[model samples]
Target: MTRSVRRTRRILQVTGVSAAALLALSACSSSDSDSSASASASGKLSGDVTVFAAASLKESFTTLGKEFEKQHPGTKVTFSFGGSDSLAASITGGAPADVFASASPKTMKIVTDAKDNATEPATFVRNQLEIATLPGNPDKVASLKDLTNSDLKVVLCDRTVPCGAAAQKALDASKLKLTPVSYEEDVKSALNKVVLKEADAAVVYKTDVKAAGEKVEGVEFPESADAVNDYPITLLKESKNPETAKAFMALVQSAEGQKVLNESGFLNP
Candidate 1:
């Protein structure tokens, strides 16, 4: 073979090898970019996030949970809703939970004081007390004083719960001494009593009355202004899915989440 021919072949060989290397590198780069894009698009949250939330949050939080699942495919959110104090007790007792959302800062303090929270609790919403009465206000209840009627069988949340505490604060503020027919464990139970016609009226959260819809009539008493409850939410330290839990917390504080809460009659924090 001629020297020039040999030189040309050598150059062609080198070029071919270089072209193959370049193509391989390009393919790898493309693959990596695709993988990253897919991951970003799919969102990083997965697994289940168990949330311990207040009873009043059942309706709003459930809605947010569904939305969170929709935004993060393959992720599930399970909620345990009850009195803030009771939920706090459960979380502090080493219950397995990804997040804790309380209807009052007082209850949230239990988790924070126990060092069970991964982060400082953030207040997401506020709620006030309302008297939930039978539909059409058949009892002719108009104010807090009306609930004190001897003939009325009024129910209230247990003093340990956020709703009951708020109700007590409102009553204290009004300087009214009234005995409730029963003190239920949570706001929902207190509201349920009125809805089921087991009680003439129930002092519950305004959100609870709203959730009850036509089943109960909400009577807003001015005294409730003094006992507004601030709802706080935090990621738990023992979360099995911390990333997903934090993402869920962010979703709850997001504008979209606030919209859901507002529609459910919760006041902005």
Candidate 2:
């Protein structure tokens, strides 16, 4: 071969080898990216997520948590359900929970204000106060005013909790004065009083009454319209499993989650 031809061939072979090497590296990078994306798309979530939620969310959230665990096989969801204010306190006090779902924005503010939330809180549900009474509503409590009867043993939630705050608002709107026999710290506690026949009536969320089942009868009062508690939820800043926590939050806002809440008597946010 001519010297020029030999030189040109050598140059071409070198260029060809370099191109092959470049192509192989590009292919490997693309493969890695595709694998990462595929893993993400498969929704492979695995972790133990702790959720602090409102007392009234017990039944519905429990159902949703089971569904979440089913969808994310290796994932576990543990819950702490109580008054919204108390839950907020725990979160603000450095409780290592993955998510926080409050019954009212006011209580959620406690966490958001303390910068304990990872994202801006979103309202997930709204609830209104209802009169929970003995089975069949033995006292015939039809409206908010009926609870004002001095003879009836009525229990109210502590003013600090979402349910209690809502109850107070409803009473203020109705311009009625009531002296409850006892003020419970949470809606569930107030509802339990009626369920146990310790109190004749208690003002609690409609969802709570439904959760109580045959133990108590619910009375819809117009005054409840004045006070609707907006439940807010968010991933906490201290969440050890942020990705799993976010997935759970998304599930709670999904259609399936809403269905469970609706079935439990909670209104849509």
Q: Write the per-residue lDDT of candidate 2 for residues 60-119, one digit (tens) a residue.
A: 999999999999899999999998888888888888898999998888898899953657
Model 1, 113-144: lDDT tens per residue?
Answer: 98645578899999988888899998889999
Per-model TM-score, in order, reads 0.85, 0.85
Q: What's the TM for model 2?
A: 0.85
Off by over 4 Å in 2: 1-43
